[model samples]
Target: MSDWKVTHSPSAGRRPRALSPLREHLRDTFWFAPATAMVGVFLVWAVASEIDTRIVEALQDRGDYDAVEELLKVADDARTVVTTVSSAMMTFIGVVFSISLVAVQMASGQFSPRVVRIFVRSRITKATFAVFLATFLLTLLVLTAYDSDPDPRLVTSVPLVQSLVTLVMVALSLLLFVMYVNTTLRLMRVGHVIDRIVGEAFGAVALLPVGASAEGHALGPETDWIAHEGRAGVLRDVNIARLVRVARQHDVVLRLIPRTGDFVVPGTPVLAVHGGRVPPYRALRYSVSVGVERTFHQDLGFGLRQLSDIALRALSPAVNDPTTAVQALDRIVQFLAALAPRPLDASLHRDRRGAVRLVQPVPGWAALVDLGFAEIRGCAVGHPQVTRRLLAGLDDLALLVPEERREPLLRHRALLAQAVERGVPEASDRTFALRPDRQGIG
Candidate 1:
């Protein structure tokens, strides 16, 4: 198995959805926020200025310079208020706009802290300066427009309403821009990261040959069988990534297989290794399918403890010589028959040719038969029950080993296989009596 680093993500149909790319595009564009505000604010400010000027001119005709001046001063104050409010709003919006991008970057699970800092600074700092400058200029314009006038109020009510509208619009624009950009950025970043991991993992596991030969008469459960037949097997390759992803998506990590209880055996392709990526990012998300077919067949192998070993060790039919080392294997028929799990389950019989003679339905033995059906297709003419039991007493457990001591695991798996063959009654005549050859299977 390849070494893997874990990351979090949601997947769809065994792949992550195209969520990030879409979010990235939408946020950067701001979805028509700040631009619209700029236009609306400018229009309203111009209209308000014109209205105030006309009022001031009318008052000048009444010989009321003092009153005119007072009205102008009020007009100027109103403009200042609009400018200041808009400025603050813009600054707040800019800060949030950049802050949101960081959240998106973090979700991607990529990029260094320095790069993220740069990203945040450019967007927010620029936003703050632009908003403040625009607001100050607008305030100056309003203050200049006001003056004291005796005959009329300092500023017309219309100009006040106009300034308020302009300020609100500008403020709203900044807010909208930040919201749109930030939200989309977050979604897009996480989605892309998740998809990359899943894709890489699946592409790697499709290479194994159904344990032995996926080709020839066996056709290794040819694609069609996987499609139509329910997947019972001599062994199953559980897609662990899919399982974990499903648990996460539902927020319920169901422990279907206990970490310590699951079994893995020799000759059994226990795990499909996952590795390599399809592109610029080498992070791969692969599926390691554990053996489904082998599970029940192995249950059958369990009962053969003393009797089967005793049978294998007998040099002829009557003499026992070998020690207890050959525990990994059992005679194919004895192993299969013992799996009639239910107390009253029927027994499997072999004919003169050593072919399966009969499968009489025993009481409550459907599960055993189903398990047999799943695995029997992989059987050759002679050897019916070859298995790769985990070195952990036929259970899969990662015994912590130093990097240098990986050889012990391999040596043990090979020795277990050899030990089983020594006791086979028809080792010379059995079709698959010969063990499979792999460099480091143990």
Candidate 2:
């Protein structure tokens, strides 16, 4: 049997590693980067306008304005064109923002609220906002150069080139607005959302260190439990490399008590140090990060949780959308199929010398199976479509999963049958329910 286990100690003070408050704040606010870029755009336009003014003055001194009278007229009209474009872009941005917000709200209410983060973090959405804001700022800067009172000989050349550039930017922003709307609409779809969640969950799985083991490490008698010392929140991420380094230096094995998405309250055991002397409490504490909600950064379970939320919501009496639940189950099967062959029991981390330094708990095959299917199955009761699809999904997983990992699927299948037997009363209905069909019928 594996001696690996998580030890909890409530009295030992420890904190989880986290970014500085400012850095974390900035990360949550997606507008910061685009806002900074807009300022840069404004400054660049202002400087370029000054240079254009000097060039125009020199050209007039050389009597170039008379030689290119058409170009002179275009420059004279540049301010009006820029002002009009800037005002129009400002109005367009407001409309786009309003529409985007409504889409986000609808997605949140229809799907899972957690998906709103996906919309907010979308690069296309951010880029659209940045381009529109930059165009507005650029035009405003150029407008400042349009002097009402100017010497006729040096009529502050309207920065015609800059105004034309602003027009080009306006066109680009319009195209992006269309693309953004399309992307937002796609995000609202059940299939797209499930695919995205599955993709990201697999991506997180890929980040795990290859060939790491979770079963061999044995706890020493001198192990000291380190308790959490902050407000309650989900464990989001841990600086594993740093924890490994600290463990190596202290010649100890640090066992992280909670998986990434596990919630921890004050005085809960966060880590267990197995060595003669515990490493500095602060060092261990600073290596783990806790947040109010789970993020996809290193928390693979979070994606599963989000998918489950979507299915649960679909199963709700108010929604009564079994097809959506069935859709979520299909993706869950895919995620688990991909994960079944991986070394999920492996949590041991070693330093360069091959000595175990850190031992963190990860969800094993059984836990993931439960996370993926248990709640949704319980709620799936009389919904023949959802129950049939789930059994079908389990059957699909059983074919893909190794013999050792198939036990949980089989066990869950038995339980699902029992639940269906109880919730769905008619014998003929029960017989049809047991049939594995993706569409919930023979």
Candidate 3:
């Protein structure tokens, strides 16, 4: 008993070395390795088998049975070919299975190199081994059949099954590819909507308790808050009425506007809002995306620079067109709005019974741009701040373009500058932040 125990203890003490991460990743990828190895081995085997068949058939036709018998020893070489083929295929399969599993698992979670390891091995990786085993069995069956007398039954069944399986897998892969593309597009649209609403337009927030699509804060791009799934307000200076205007501007129609002289003296509570009214814009923002294509109703989204090529290729296949470009303009407005910080509605609820007053007196050159945009788009410039910021961005980026394009773009700037030099009532600094109570019409 002591001798037996001593031998077992010695073996236990010399435990096997732990596998490296790479080895472990490839450990269950036995199928990929085998599949790859088999391809090469099978190629050699096929060539040899063809030569053997030709020689044997020719010799038989020539009535040389004795030569066929003499050359029979060559058949043993088939084993070497098959074995090498299987080993090579197993090795290749292991590598791909390991890599694919690790990548997908890493993508599924927080994207850390460490925590991702826990879920690294998945059902697909394990299933790959089964596929490899099936392939090996099929190879063995084929080799066995080649040596045996041809049976019409085996011939019809094996090839039919192989064709069916190939067809099924091809169909499945195509379906998955389409689904992945669609989902990615949807997420992109969400990011753009949020960015336009928060980053550029600022009107994305005019309506709500509900706000711009928070999706942009998560998965948009590299520095993309969307990828990290961070939560930030998608609006700034967002009061309830501004929120309403923001909503209405984006087609969040509640039908609460006044009709012709609906008997209003002063202080008539016109609109009543609930939380339900706000999420539509956010939803719409998240839902509006295209895959590798720009649309006539395009968006000036967060990741447009990266996506422009795919979009333009998809949209204009022939010529550069502004019809698709205008959609991008709206998208830009929405994406920026998604990042705007939410303001406390303190101003809205403030006791302005008589205190509602004008914002301040400053030359509203920015307002002039907003007005021009409003004229071109045929939408009331919902919020002046959004238009102001857009103009500022245009002015800042003007130098990036060629001298020729700059002149045309700057013509609007020139017009605004002229307005500032002269005087428009809306262009007054005081009128920019006009208080509700101070409205001349109301």
To one decimal, what is the Cα RMSD in angstroms of model 1 from the true structure? 24.0
Q: Candidate 2: worst 10 consecutive residues by lDDT?
A: 7-16
What pairs collide in candidate 2? 15-285, 16-288, 17-286, 17-288, 214-346
Query: Which residue runs of candidate 1 sit more than 4 Å off their true CA positions?
Result: 1-36, 59-70, 76-80, 86-90, 110-162, 170-442
Instruction: Put down candidate 1 lDDT per residue, 1-442, tens digits, no spaces.
Output: 2222221111212332224323322333432333543454466567877875676666766767776666545656775666666457556646765666567566323322222322332334335434444454454455444433433544443355455545654674566456556644543442332222222222321211112111111101111101112222322223333433433433322222211113444333222112211111111122222333221111222222222322233222233222211221222222323322223222222222322211112222333222322232122122223332222322221133223333433454455445445544576533243434221123
What tens-digit string does per-residue lDDT give for candidate 2 at 164-186?
Answer: 77778878888988898898889
TM-score against native, each model = 0.26, 0.85, 0.24
* Residue 71 lDDT, candidate 3, scale 0-100: 46
- Lowest summed lDDT across 10 adjacent residues in model 3 is found at 1-10
For TM-score, the strongest prediction is 2
- Kindly provide the TM-score of model 3 when superposed on the true structure, using C-alpha atoms: 0.24
Candidate 3 residue lDDT tens string, 26-106: 532345554654464455445544555566667677776666554443333444555454456556556654665655453
* Model 2, residue 396: C-alpha shift (Å): 2.2
Which one wins by TM-score: 1 or 2?
2
Clash number for every model? Answer: 54, 5, 67
- Indicate whether candidate 2 or candidate 3 has the larger lDDT: 2
